[model samples]
Target: MDALKEGWFSEINDLWPGIAVSLEVTKVLHREKSQFQDILVIDTKAHGKALVLDGIIQCTEHDEFSYQEMISFLPLCSHPNPKNVLIVGGGDGGVAREVVKHPDVEKVIQVEIDPAVMEVARTHLPFMAASLDDPKLTVNIGDGFEFMKKHRGEFDVIITDSSDPVGPAECLFQESYFALMKAALKPNGIICSQAGTAWANLDHVTKTLNHCRTVYPVTAYGIAAVPTYPTGQIGFVLGSLDPTTNFREPIKIFTEEELDKMKMKYYNDKIHRGAFTLPRFVEKALTSSHEIPQESRKEL
Candidate 1:
């Protein structure tokens, strides 16, 4: 089995049974049990340095840009004027790096439950942690839930860069957390979260969408290809406070020159629109406002 292979480190995702992704570990760079979860850093044979939290790969040096750019830019671009942004649980600093790239963004406040995640990223994964030092960004080491509670209706865009829904991150995927996100946003504010792997966790996607519908009238789903994540694809759930907001269309489309300046890798206006066009099975499972009959369900 891959788990027992020599010089290999593997993460077995319980949600996805009978599969484990392994990497050729050159060395164990760092390991610690933080206040919240187990944080690990390793030098890999293929993906360069990797950040693992609670034995799950969160991001790798090679493909980190895909996740950081998509999650940060999707909601920011969809909002009319996202001058203020809030990031919950992205202690690694990749999301903060992308958020500060927008010239229109005046401020970004990140709340991380565990400071060790950021410290490990800084010491080992410096590339991903570089933006933690941006002047416009503030790193708050506290519970995101309490932070949002105190600062209500203050943010234009909120991004939840949480880990999967288990252990320390389990509460982040619950309905109460969605309600907290709604309260933290302005009237026209937009929010996006790393939902899960739709192909493997369709039930999780459906539950998140149902909770979002109860709060935000405008809710949409998007997916990105991240090989390190389970099923080689991950999904996002977006919700907008504005009733008429079209999550498919980004209000602020960056020029190619601007994208180059921002050092963006995977997020573009066209990709933003295309991400919402889900597979038939996924669409049927997460169709927010409609119910398909049994006969039609099989056809799809």
Candidate 2:
């Protein structure tokens, strides 16, 4: 039974083998949690219900906000100033917390497809999840693709914290989805999306980066370390209308000088720039235009 558990966990998720809020066989709800694309929502510790897809946690209702914050803030901080922001995916209300951190941000809209995930998060991860209740935030639980269609050229920043590109989050990685997101941003707006890991999913990251360049003037890739994410390494795809105009200078939000106080453990000037550094293998894969093989990947 232990070995089978290891195999199930190893095959489907990037999280550490044992790091979780809680783990109990959920027999209640009289549901097996299999109808939701093999994704099971298990009640966990402070973070809330964890979405375990195919026996692996695709996302959790709790502690996901931390991942969202570092993802959103670094890019959000990169932009000299960001006002309106749009979040695609992230039904857990994590991204919304980080966006409101900056005082300059006046409006934020988060579009999520699953209502159940959002409800679990709201009831569980409260401190960071509190932003979901903010009047400044307009929470829409539905298709992100449709929402982008109506709000053209509106947002200053767009953050995509999507799940793996296999099931529900697949469309979030398509060329058309990016095109619509590009259209929904202001002229000088910036775009950033979780491109998975350079170590495990180089093909996915490279594909996203290349596709983004076709629509936006500038496309760059960066990475950060989140212990729970796949390979404990994750990358981001950033696109800007004009890369030159999208520069950052330390301001009231903690400029290069006051950044000492910020003391963000993960983000720094060097780390920010280094996240774009691709390994020889990835660089080769992107240049050669070959789909990275399944065997090369480290599973989930």
Candidate 3:
């Protein structure tokens, strides 16, 4: 963990104006305005190399595994057989890195709009970008929505490793994106996406879950703790094509030897179940018998 002698990179979340997280910056590896947003790769004091997009911290070497492993494995393990997977907006390659670890997965198609993000990640974040060259992975540089529209009932599992609901990623959190993902999933397939934070954006979690229910009969929510993210936690929305799919339990169990072989750092069968246990307020908001009042509904 190398610390910078003088400079620092501060991530200020406009949505949550009260708090800001900063890392001691050692050196800037890359900085550029790509086709979408501002991309930056920096070496930090304690978290090692980190990726920042639009002045927000996306992932760091220290705790990125928690987010990558949880998001990728949660939906894949919940399905009976996840062979062909589609990842939307994981340009850094962390999600792809985790998706290829499942032995049952035969192919992975990653769609990212920005090629610059992948190029920077490959050079600065090798731990996550290492799997971009795997034979099982097929990288496509294009809009994820347009790509999914052409492929229907094709993917067994679809994971959206997108940034928060802002800038280029704003559309990714809308109902239309989930609708497209629903149409692209196999009959018994499952889809998962990074759905903001429960503590900071409960409205985001509630509305996203509500939108998902419109497309997929089986919909649930999960959370993971990451130090670099806002509120030190992130939430995921999961939807299943089959109404009876229980997301809390793993359909395909992994043995200890298999888990060790995968070298999973943060995700396991027990952790999968525990991730869905939301706080009282979040549970009430997401599963309320009555509609959320007009005053209670704040725009996400």
Candidate 4:
């Protein structure tokens, strides 16, 4: 891997107090050259900072609620009564924050490798940063994969919010990780992960989705439009223990009265269901179910 400093700081004119940031060109110089997928670490901010791989915006200044809320709540809301939740690779504590919102969630264990991310998020992004301090949350700074190995059949929901398939987070995009995650889930548990960009990373997204199908009986995919992400596109892969779970039905998840109480920024029954409505091209790509062998995926 190589590093090159870019004009990232200059791009963001409005710098905040105590905000420490770093941007470097990251490379994987093996058989396939994926130069755009560089690793970026922004720390020393009011909250803790983060490391983002590829061009995808793993976390941002504005609203992480939209991403974390949708990903965690999608399966959480569906669960009859979720007790414990395990978040893999979400060091920033965004997902943990939302998971605890459920009245029934007793404990939330978040395993993130980078401690810098937790610090930056807590210091800078207050809306989400404070999630790290939730009484029901426990922070674990280490490899999420290794944590999964130690705690198999532990959590009712496991949400993977790692960066795109590149740099340090590349391993999370593999089929083996999905299998490991399945083993880490309780019999009634479900898993949701940020796959990749639907536009720029169709192959990566499809590959993850296909792999999920091989592991979980119930698997489906969804998309979101996050401005900071590459081409303003984001996608998620969902897996469950049951073989036949459908996400399309029930446009209205809550009563009009309940909707008023929980008026969210980006997600609703309509938006949640619409997020799964993929484009024709994506539909076709998903039709041909096959893993993108590392050799062939690298060629493109």
Off by over 4 Å in 1: 288-300
Off by over 4 Å in 4: 1-56, 250-252, 255-263, 290-300
What tens-digit string does per-residue lDDT give for candidate 2 at 190-263? Answer: 88888877776676777887677667765666666665555766677777775564323323355665444533
> lDDT by residue for model 1 over 95-196, one digit each (tens)?
999999988899999999999999998899888899999999999999999999999999999999999988988898888999999899988898899999
- Model 3, range 1-300, lDDT digits (tens) per residue? 122224988777676677778899888989899988999889888999999999889999999999999999999998888999999999999999999999999999999999999999988899999999999999999999999989999999999999988899999988898999989998988999999887888888888887877777678889999999989999999988876788888887788888899998888899998998888888888877325443432211
Best by lDDT: 3
Per-residue lDDT for 134 in model 1?
95
Error of 4 at 128 (Å): 1.4
**What is the overall TM-score of model 3 with all chains considered together?**
0.94
Best-first order by lDDT: 3, 1, 4, 2
Return the lDDT, model 3, position 69.
Answer: 95
User: Can you write out model 4's per-residue Cα lDDT over 1-300, one digit (the tens) per residue?
Assistant: 222234342112111222233333233111222232344445423323433534334665444567877887777765656788988877667778777766678999989887766665565456676768889998888889899999989888889988655567778888899999999998867789988766766777778888887787667788777655455667788887754445554322665565556545666677777877889888878767655443332110
- TM-score, prediction 1: 0.94
TM-score of every prediction relative to native? 0.94, 0.76, 0.94, 0.76
- Better candidate by TM-score, 1 or 3: 1
Which residue runs of candidate 2 sit more than 4 Å off their true CA positions?
1-3, 6-56, 59-66, 245-265, 268-270, 287-300
Give the higher-lDDT candidate: 2 or 3: 3
Better of 3 and 4 by TM-score: 3
lDDT of 4 at 79: 63
Task: Give the C-alpha lDDT of model 2.
Answer: 0.65
